[model samples]
Target: MALNENEVLAGLAEIVAEETGIEADQVQMDKSFTDALDIDSLSMMTIVTLAEEKFDVRIPDEDVKDLLTVGDAVKYITKAQA
Candidate 1:
């Protein structure tokens, strides 16, 4: 099955919110995960793992650099599904 961007955004928001202790409603697409969520590389790796498990998409460590914002993740996940 293909991944849904809306679903990805919602799930990613929940994941980030849970991991960062932030309100999910406050997670915007343009927000920088590092600056906004204050997540480190380890946390990012955890997020990547969670995304892989949830969306069944492969997010290489090298690709993690491209996922600076929530929108980038959404785009990558959707593209990976295709």
Candidate 2:
């Protein structure tokens, strides 16, 4: 089943929080994963791997580079689900 936008966002925030120790509530749409969350590339890759397992979506490495913000991830996962 495809998750809605809010559901994707919530799940993604949880994944980010678990991986980086950032509060889920702090994972807002406009926040940049690197600049705002201070997530390094290794952390980002781990987060991506976990998110792929949780969301059952394949986020290619090339595509990942384009997903800069929280909203970008949420939208990509949501679309991938569909």
Candidate 3:
């Protein structure tokens, strides 16, 4: 099954919540992944792994680094799936 942007956003939010111990609703799309979600590089790597597993796609390291916000992650996932 292909993942849409909304699905990616929701899935990413779930992963972020799980990894950071934060509520899913607390992660806004516009918020910074580090500043708002308190996600460090390791957490981001976990998130990338989760996303790749969920979507069955590999997100490149260069692309992963650019995903600094919820929207960016969603967009990256959508593009990767495309």
User: Tens-digit lDDT track for model 2 on 1-82?
Assistant: 9999899999999999898899999999999999999999999999999999999999999999999999999999999999
Q: Which candidate number has the best TM-score?
A: 2
**Candidate 3 runs further than 4 Å off:** none
Q: Rank the candidates by TM-score, best first.
A: 2, 1, 3
What's the TM-score of every candidate structure?
A: 0.89, 0.97, 0.89
On lDDT, the candidate that comes out on top is 2
- What lDDT tens digits, residue by residue, belong to model 3 across residues 2-23? 7777787788878888888989
| Model 1 C-alpha lDDT per residue in residues 1-82, reported as the tens digit of each score | 7867888899988887777777888777888888986789888888889988888889988999989998999899999988
Clashes of 3: 0
Q: Is candidate 1 or candidate 3 better by lDDT?
A: 1
Q: How accurate is candidate 3 locally (lDDT)?
A: 0.83
The better candidate by TM-score, 2 or 3, is 2
The CA-based lDDT of model 2 is what?
A: 0.94
